[model samples]
Target: MKKAKLLAALGICGLILGACGAEDDSKYDTSTTEVSESEAVVKEPGLDELDPAVSEELSKMGTDEEIDWEKINFNKRQYKEYIESLDEQETDSSETGESTLTVVSSSMVDDNTIEIVINNTDASEMSELTNGFFAIMMDTFSRQLYLNSDYSDGTNQPTIIIKDNAGTVISEETDFIEMEETE
Candidate 1:
């Protein structure tokens, strides 16, 4: 269940990032020099190697301010592995205590968009479940792509709407938080 939630959060973040657009400022060649079948020379530019205009445009695209772009892995294999690790973080469920969150359901609407229904086990709204489990979620979902509008302040209903690349809402979930009092 935890893994499912984390994957959903990551999908949400990726979708949000995909929605941001940045104009290309540089026309640098990306072709590789073939030395051999297994040893082609690739031009992997680091963040510092990018033109100032290009860097500025990327920064504006909601890239995390905390990310050290210089240290990013340019290798496709390594990058994919790093992303997998992020989604598979180890958590001691027994030591973590009871989860206040109850994942009602989740589904992917497209390649990028996903919607998750979260229930606050201890409170009527998720705004009240902003403690233990909330912290865990926030920590795990600390992607810069998360917009302020993605969350509720307890004053309104909780809804998750993930959009496609064309800015069309692919997944829309309403009433994720139950508001009824149990007898």
Candidate 2:
């Protein structure tokens, strides 16, 4: 009878141990699935150059004064240097355009990408107008360009430009304005 009881207790302990082992395996399987899925979705850029025209445009849209430009972390020095050089070039190029108005600001999104905002004028209805203008320009360039007007401050006004390694505008330029503001 004692032997029978010992045998029954051992069976119960074996069942519990088996269930615990199965639970551990399930956790490891779930973690592996998540890692593999993430690896599949994250696409890296193929090119490492920036278009001079786009760089010039971004430069004119100065860095957000309230946000520090030097401290923000960037994935690549080439990307940051391109943005800085563009801003300096835009400032120098402004005198060349009598009717064209450009405001520039830049922020780092991660190690790989930078967000550039450009605004043309101060009118309340300028957001859509500017965006449409940029969209056409991006289409003409045959690149994917993104337009993000909602990202701007009330005073600074925002128009976002996104570019990939081919220096192709991956986002639509929905934030460009061609009309001159009236006095």
Candidate 3:
């Protein structure tokens, strides 16, 4: 009976030692790993490549205007932050994901009704929050421009149109224009 108990204890010890010494499959074995030289390097598309249409539109607007492109570009970061701040207001799962923001065009229609279209797409998931964010961003952008220039000096206020990737109009606000003073 003592011999049987000793053998059982030895078996348990063997099991414990085996389990403890067992190789971990979770850890990657770099020593035996072979990397192929033919592996393709994926490159992200640059801003110019992402939206050629928008670039074309901007180019057509002409550079004769006094607008500060540097300030406008810098303001884009704030616009992004403003959108992120509104995430808590998002109750839909479809609205949460990576997104790309692009200003399609800014056109002054007869020096009164200026139209600005901003195109955005959720990189992963689609949500109402995406649209909501764009709306707020457009408002912010308009406000920034209006505060800096006489574009709102005439009877017409600017109208902004926000669109998504599928050419679907997400949001449009005509009242966003700041009325001009009658001097």
Candidate 4:
């Protein structure tokens, strides 16, 4: 029950920030700056690496925008409070040998990275939260950071990893690594 609530709260925050930060068609930047052929384009963290579908959805969730300090602080507070509440929940905690999700830590790894660690849970279990699984899971956390963090400098890599309660990484899931150009 606590695990479900934690996911729900995180999802709600994602939804709220997504809605608040989204850019509609009317807000398109009309200014054009020409770049020379020799100029190298600096890629935003994890942008080119993401699956096309995930990239599109992340853009829709809102990126390349000004910092929303008020919203960021608000969400941070909410996240902290929710995390604090997890410990207060009752736990029989007897190792019936069944794995249970005990801790969920969500935070920015840097201005360029957002990391979400699910303790005592398998990465595959995350699919249970959505109808369609891995892509949605990847999109959700990436979008959450894109919409909520101080990711203004074209730097933001999002990672989702699962670990056992013993603090060992069980899996480093998601195709967030940059791909080679096949063409």
Candidate 5:
């Protein structure tokens, strides 16, 4: 699935970026925006204004019955600005190439849990590699949720489940990854 590939690629890139250290963000200064009390309060853009694809995905972020729409909708302006800020950065995909760990599907199973199914690849120590990817992926994924002021649950870190190609969950929990022993 293209979505799976894109998410895996993003996770890989996120790992690379973490090792590379934080980039200089001084160019985008917010000090100038010192609106006085007399200035009218401006209304920010809603989720409707975001890229349809992203908006749709974020709209379905939380629970099915009582989705995170309320929280996400309240911060549509924040997400819009966040996405726009990301677009400002330039990245070359050719440098990263392809990721060895293929993600079958990364789904949000609950408000505080993310289930990621990764296909078994030729990489040695598959479990070890999967654990590493899980940490990186969870950390990266949590940032988006943690960005929302209203999202306060599960130690402020969503639990991540990693599964093998056969759709068997091999790892569960977060921060500290615990693998399920197989026969």
Candidate 6:
């Protein structure tokens, strides 16, 4: 019951943030600057190594505009309080076996990308837990960005990356990695 409610709340928050993005489209500069042929070459992220489906998904989520990272704050007082409440609710944890998650830190790789590092005691169970919560985290983070920043240009969609304690990547929630152009 609690899980269902939490998911619903997160979904609502995502919708609110999506609305927020639409309002700030004017903040982005629309001026076109001419660049030389050499300067116009854009470097892409190494995503060809991933499976075709995964690569395709990431591309759809990628935004060309850079995000203004200075204004994003997910650990503000209200959100911190909310996070604390979530911790308290975990006393009635649904899982039976040992499944613990400790968030190490979260930071921006770029404007639209938020990487959340966590230490899960059960490495074997990491995939299951990550898969379960990835959507929620993505929505929550994206919503938080809109709530905290006035610079949302609709390109503020967050791509969440989850990595385990041993520096192993557990899961990625976005399909926006840059792919090489096939000749």
Which candidate gets the maximum lDDT versus the true structure? 5
Would you list the C-alpha lDDT of every candidate in the order shown? Answer: 0.39, 0.42, 0.50, 0.45, 0.54, 0.52
Best by TM-score: 5
TM-score of 6: 0.35
- What lDDT tens digits, residue by residue, belong to model 6 across residues 22-109? 8877888767677789878554333223345433433443377444444333333333333333323322122764765656665555
- What TM-score would each prediction reach against the true structure? 0.24, 0.27, 0.34, 0.28, 0.35, 0.35
- Candidate 6: worst-modelled 10 consecutive residues by lDDT: 85-94
- Backbone collision tally, model 1: 0
List per-candidate RMSD values in Å.
21.9, 16.2, 18.0, 22.4, 23.2, 21.6
Report the candidate with higher lDDT, 2 versus 5.
5
Off by over 4 Å in 3: 1-98, 123-126, 154-156, 176-183
Error of 5 at 90 (Å): 18
The per-prediction tally of clashing pairs is 0, 23, 3, 0, 0, 3
Give candidate 6 regions above 4 Å deviation.
1-99, 123-127, 142-144, 175-183
Compute the lDDT of residue 109 as modeled in candidate 1: 35
Ranking of predictions according to TM-score? 5, 6, 3, 4, 2, 1
Estimate, for each residue in 1-183, the C-alpha lDDT of model 3 and write its tens digit: 999999999999999998986778568555856667677554544333424443443354325544443333212333333233332333223344545555555444443343445555545454556666756655655555443343455354455555554656666666553435998
Query: Model 1 over residues 67-94: C-alpha lDDT tens digits?
Result: 4433322232222232233324332223
Instruction: List model 5 lDDT by residue over 1-183, tens digit each.
Output: 999999999999999997766466566676787778779676776544754644655656333643343344324345434433432332212235543445555555655666665554445555566546654544454445444533444356656666766867666765544446999
Model 1 TM-score? 0.24
Candidate 4 per-residue C-alpha lDDT over 91-143 given as tens digits, one digit per residue, 9 for 90 to 100: 22336744444445545444434444444333465533421233244435444
Q: How would the candidate models be sorted by lDDT, starting from the highest? A: 5, 6, 3, 4, 2, 1
Better of 4 and 6 by lDDT: 6
